[model samples]
Target: MNFVKRAGMSLGARKPRTAALLAIFVVLCTLLLGGFLLQSAAARQEADAQRTVGVDVTVRKKGLTPALADRIGAADPVHRYSPEVPVRAEARGFTPLVADVPAPEGDGAGQREQGPLAVTGVRDLGMLLPFSYGSTKTTEGRGITPEDAGRNVAVIEQRLAAGNHLGVGDTVHARSADGRREVALKIVGIFQDPRRDQPGWAPPHELPGNTLYVPVRTAQTLGTGPAKVTEAVYKVGSPDRAGQLHAAAERILGGGGFDFRVNDKAYRDQVRPVQRVGAFAGLIVWVITLAGALVLGLIVTLQIRERRAELGVLLSLGEKKWKLIGQHAVEVAAVALPAVALAALAGSLAGQHAGDALLGRQGDEPVTAAGAPDTVTAPPAVRVEPAAVGKVAGIGLGISLVSTVVPGLGILRLHPRSLLTDSE
Candidate 1:
């Protein structure tokens, strides 16, 4: 009769042994599929962390010009760059919030009594520390954007706006401390500051409410000499890319007084754990596949020993030795297909829960250490994909083939008479 038909009949006759093999296959396949799912999920989360919670590289020097800042910002690894220039201006018609304590008697005390407002020129207001940290928020109109680079505009604190009966679209005049240069800034936005005035002696400009954000050109106009930024900050996609940014900056700024500080504490606290999980999941996949193959190979070898008489009778009847191996391979494959299906079902049902258990659900607020700002990275969740199922199916087939074919090699050298004597 045909070997395929005989293989089917053999499986039907041995109900208990077939069920045991199916059970083992299901367990092995389920573990392998789970490992694949975890690996996929961890990789997705790591990418998200890299994109949103990357390292911040701060470049500080005495006089970092915007021209030099633009050159360094053009690097391939830098995502964005912000150049800040701080200048003092005395309010023309409105009073700024001041500390309650009396002014100290000193040589510069006369200038301290004036309490000029602190005007900060920025390429992008949203990238500033206070706004980025959520400590300050625009309550009316809009914050200064990159498009307002050369425009004369300002976004002032709401407290200063309300005290002076000012609102958006109103014009505010500011004169430089030297009284040589002045600017008429249109109030485009009003922001809210959570902090209050300090009790100890401090200048009016030092108060949070007296701060003003203006375009880089407007602040530069009030300065005496060449346009220069106080500091420049460049953002990179990940901690690893900080080196690339450093090299780029060196090409522009060179090895001078410019100091580069890289802050990657947030990346370390969040992204590193996800990376480790991905690596561990990959290791688990190889371990389970090798162990499953070894266990199944041993099982097949013992069954071949037990069926020596059956094999000898087949060989004596002029049956081909390759057909005997084919029958064994078919039997194992029959069990493997269903086990893969069962594993797919189980993975779809419990993949997310298992992932959450392994990689704990991350909080909305990124973990910050050593004064690092909170990042906006959202944690990724585990999901089932068709590709993962296909991988499990392929692996299952490989294990089945290796386990059956390696043990069947012993049958080729055995003679029919020797097999009959071994069975007797």
Candidate 2:
């Protein structure tokens, strides 16, 4: 009889044993496919997190102008950009917040010198650390955005707005100390600052309640000299891209007094855990494969010993020893195909739940937008794919061959006489 036909007959004759072996094969294949799926999912999530969470690059110099900031912000690697320019301005209409501490009894003596309110210009106020970190919140209307770049708009602290009886759409006036440059700003938002007047006597511009956020252009208009920014912040998709942004800045601003600081805390917080999950999944795959091979190999060896009478009968009929081994390999490999199919189905159904159990729930950090409302994106999810199935099938075949062929070697060394005598 053909070896393949004989192998099929043997499996049909031993239905109970075949069913038990088939059950074992399915469990091994399921775990192998699950591991592959997990590793693939973790890699995909890490890449997505890097792009969404991103890294912040801060460039600071003595006289960083708006023009230079714009040039750096225009880099391809930069996802979002903001330039900060701070200026002191005296309130024209309302009584601004003054320091509670007693004024120095000297040149600028006890004469109750009301200081100017703090005016900070930015391309996007939402991207400010205070607002993004939740230290300051927009309690009314909206905050200054990139669209307000050329417009005369402002977002004031709640206390300052309350003191002046200002609401959204109200106009406020401020002037330079010299009274030479004046700016009329329309209030678009009101933010709450959890700060009080300090004990030390300082200018109003340095006071927390007197702080106001406005478009970078509006603040620049109040200045006399060339328009300059205190510092510029650019956000890139990944920490590795910080070098690209730095190179772009070097090309435009040159390597001088400017320094670049990269903040990758968000990236580290988010991506590192996913990387560890992937590594653990890879380890699981190797360990499972080896264990499955050893277990199946031992089972095949014992089955061969019990089938000595059958093997002796086949050898007495002049069947080739290699064909005897080939029959056993064919039986094991036949069981592997259905096992892989069942594994693929199980993975497609339960992969996501397994991934979540392993990775746990990861919270997405909120991202403050330039001109749009605050948004948070959902994290990437685990999924089963054809590639993972194919890998499991390939590994299953290798396991079957190793389990059957190595033990089958013992049969090849015995002659037909010794085989029949041993059976007797």
- CA lDDT scores, all candidates in order: 0.82, 0.83
- Pairs that collide in candidate 1 are none
Q: Which one is best on TM-score?
A: 1
- For each candidate in turn, the TM-score is 0.86, 0.81
Error of 1 at 233 (Å): 1.8
Runs in model 2 lying further than 4 Å from the true structure? 90-95, 99-115, 141-152, 168-188, 237-239, 243-248, 315-326, 364-380, 409-418
- What TM-score does structure 2 among the candidates reach? 0.81
User: Which residue pairs does candidate 2 place in steric collision?
Assistant: none
Please give the TM-score that candidate 1 achieves against the real structure: 0.86
Full-model lDDT, candidate 1 = 0.82
After TM-score superposition, the amount by which residue 2's alpha carbon in candidate 1 deviates from its true location, in angstroms, is 3.5
Instruction: Sum up the clashes in candidate 2.
Output: 0
Candidate 1 lDDT tens digits, 1-424? 7888898999999999999999999999999999999999888887766665667788887667988888888899987667898887788878877667876777236655443688888877766656655677777888787788878999999889988999999998888766787789999888888988887877777888899989888888876567778788776878779999888888888666568898887678767888888899999999999999999999999999999999999999999999999999999999999999999889889988889877677536543221123444444676668898889889998999999999999999998999999999
